[model samples]
Target: MKKRNTCLICLQGLSGSGKTTVANFLASTLNIPVYHSDVERKKLFGLSPTENSSLANLDIYTKEATIRTFQKLYELAFEELSAQQSVLVDAAFLRHHERLRMQQLARDTGALFLIVKCQAGQQIMIDRIRTRQHLGNDPSEASEDLIHKQKQWQEALTSDELQTCIKVFTEEKNWQETLLQRIYRYIS
Candidate 1:
């Protein structure tokens, strides 16, 4: 059998920064599986992706829950990588250690690792959160308050990480195409 090429794309940003959007778009365009923290976290409690997790009487946003969620995401990615498939992971990787975990996973699997740092203005993030809440169509349960808190918690990518990173302005009109082109260029 021919050796298959695979990549682990980590999409990280603040709440409502549109990292999920980028992840979904990339997954569809590239025909790859994508693991999403928001969706998986809710699933852990037997909840639907768009269901109101707030009403589940369980705090899925707790640190322990987050750790478990990221672990699950990594495991899911590992399965795909073991099968020689590329995968995308979507989450707000606020801590440096969270980002490192994914990087290490990529190394362990011998897959090319890339980070897509989705970004938007604070106001834009807040607005997006509000709109998403009103629609209740997204798996994310982030609020406007979370946006402010996330701004304080998010760590900038280190110089070394930037070597394999792409800064995506999700606020831009043609961001999907731009990001796709950049990824194609990088992987080529």
Candidate 2:
């Protein structure tokens, strides 16, 4: 069996590092569903995906709002995993502690926890973000400025986290297959 009944795939990366694209790919390939942080963040403020929302907007991305979004994201992922469904969380989880929280949730639920740190070159990220924005109706409400902000404050994954982490350099051609094999090793 190459599939676990329940596994939490948490994607941690900076904005425009290709988290969303990879999340969608993983979910589609592995028959899982994704709970996107950006989309959920917008929902927290009663705004739709295409609507304007930003970290600058305290009402939408306030400290309290961020906490609530994470809480709700965890809630949704927990519920889905509890029901024996694998879940993929699409988020730029810049904080190590929040990633640990998700790990703990998996432990509490007896599900496999895997943190996939997605990475790409700076130019690649900027290009991707620009393209996504140009496409219109992007689910992420984050500004391109977030790309810079995330780079400044990101708590990069540590050696301790490497045990359960699969590092995927999204710019690499074999990255997707590499991650799938790594994940199948745990789930299967």
Candidate 3:
């Protein structure tokens, strides 16, 4: 029997870099399940995705919370992978360690692992954050300050990680379709 093609697609980048958008696009196009960190983080705390953690006196973005959130994401992804299904994860993945853990999960499950790093111009990122904040509907509570901080601390992919990685510049027209094609070609 031929083995099924399954993968853990990690959509990663700094906040406001269009990771969520790309994840959604890929999820729909590929008909795969998507697990978003922000939504999962809030769910872990018994809060709605758009609920402000600060307003509830809960800092879901704390170090411990982040660890729990990633663990939850990994577990969720593992379930899908173990079931022979492809899964997409949307997260900042700001640290190399985070990516490493996910990579190990993929390896353990015998699923292909691919990293899609979504990017936009700095100004566009700032503008997108502002617009999302103004609308107040996104699960992500990333502020302009948060994005700047992420820029300072976000780790670049190592050589090995780069081998399985693709960069998406989201500001261009038809980016989703282009990226979809690229992902299909890469996986094939």
lDDT of each: 0.88, 0.84, 0.90
C-alpha lDDT (0 to 100) for residue 15 of candidate 3: 88
All candidates' TM-scores?
Answer: 0.95, 0.90, 0.96
Instruction: List model 2 lDDT by residue over 112-177, tens digit each.
Output: 888888899988888888887888678875557988887898887877778988888999988888
Worst 10 residues of 2 by lDDT: 52-61
lDDT of 1 by residue, 16-81 (tens): 889988888898888899999999999988999998876877788898999899999989999999
C-alpha positional error of residue 170 in candidate 2 after TM-score superposition, expressed in Å: 1.2
Cα displacement (Å) at residue 125, model 3 = 0.8
Where does model 1 exceed 4 Å of error?
1-4
Which pairs, if any, clash in model 1?
none
lDDT of 3 by residue, 43-147 (tens): 999999989888999888899999999999999999998999989999999899999999999999888899999999988999999999899899989999998
CA lDDT for candidate 2:
0.84
Candidate 1 global lDDT:
0.88
Rate residue 23 of model 2 by lDDT: 94
For model 2, the superposed segments whose C-alpha errors exceed 4 Å read 1-5, 54-59
